[model samples]
Target: MNETIGNIKSRRSIRAFKQEQIKDEELQLILEAGLYAPSAHNQQSWHFTVIQNKEILDDLNESSKEAGKIFNDKYIQQLSNNEKFHTFYHAPTAVIISGKKDSLMPFADCAAATQNMLVAAQSIGIGSCWIGLVSLVFNGEKAKKYQDKLGIPEGYQPYHAVALGYKKVKSTKAFARKENTVNYIR
Candidate 1:
């Protein structure tokens, strides 16, 4: 297989991370890869906020806890008890992907950008996890502080976030794909 194809096939979601932080140069490359993702009508309405400060990361975790409180679900309540259950998964660096409020293709565009970042991270031996919990807090008052602190503008909303760091363990097993999910036109 081609190197690029191998990287794509080997990429996996890493929830466990090493304590070491990702280098600035490598992080920039990952962000640049995300920026190169295709956008609808070339709107390129996505904005990425790279967070490296531990203080801000802790605050974001607190906000996630607050947001989880609004839900009556038992599982959500349980999440609050897990001190390590941060929206950014305690990674040394987090990249928040935000999109314009009025864009119809915001979610799609942001998703592509995030995937690009993930693949780029994997290719460089860095681990990344796509975090949706932060986006869940986007509409609530609890997220306002994070939005402001992260420099997300008024007209933008966070759609997704990626936690980047060194992987603690590497899994060699490929995931088993479920059948009946795809339909062929031919």
Candidate 2:
């Protein structure tokens, strides 16, 4: 198999990360990878906001938990109650992927960019995790204030966030694949 295939097969979701920040050059390459992801009409409607400041991240974490409390989801409520729960897992950097709310395929476009970032991160020995809980904070009516604080463009909305940093503990376990997933129609 080719190196790219090997990288794809070996990628895993990383939850633990070291305090050290990723190098600027490496971070740029990862961001570039995201920029290269296929988009509808090449609209490239995505806007990536990379946050390296620890204080801002801390605020986001706290506010996300606070927002979680308003949700009826048992999981969200439970997570909100846990003091240890952080949306970004304390990673050194976070990239928020946003797109125009009116776009026909904004979610899918942002998702592709996020996946590209993830694979690029893994290939470069960086750890990454896609954070979705922030949506809870953004989608709710009460979150408009927080959304403004995030500095997302007026017409755009964030679709995903990715935490990036060096791994504190490498994931060595292989994931088990479910069998018979495909239905061949030929």
Best by lDDT: 2
CA lDDT of each candidate?
A: 0.86, 0.87
**lDDT (tens digit, per residue) of candidate 2 on 1-186:** 887887777778888889999999999999999999999988888989899999989988887788788787999889988999888999999999998878778898999999999999989999999997776767867567866777888888888999999999886766788999989889
Cand. 1 TM to true fold: 0.91
Sequence-dependent TM-score of model 2: 0.93
lDDT computed for candidate 1: 0.86
Candidate with best TM-score: 2
Runs of candidate 2 with Cα error greater than 4 angstroms are none
lDDT of 1 by residue, 1-186 (tens): 898898888988887888788899999999999999999888888999998988888888787777776766778778866776776767899999999878779889999999999999989999998987777678787567767877898889999999999988884567888889989898
Looking at model 2, report the run of 10 residues with the lowest lDDT sum. 140-149
Q: Which pairs, if any, clash in model 2?
A: none
Clashes of 1: 0
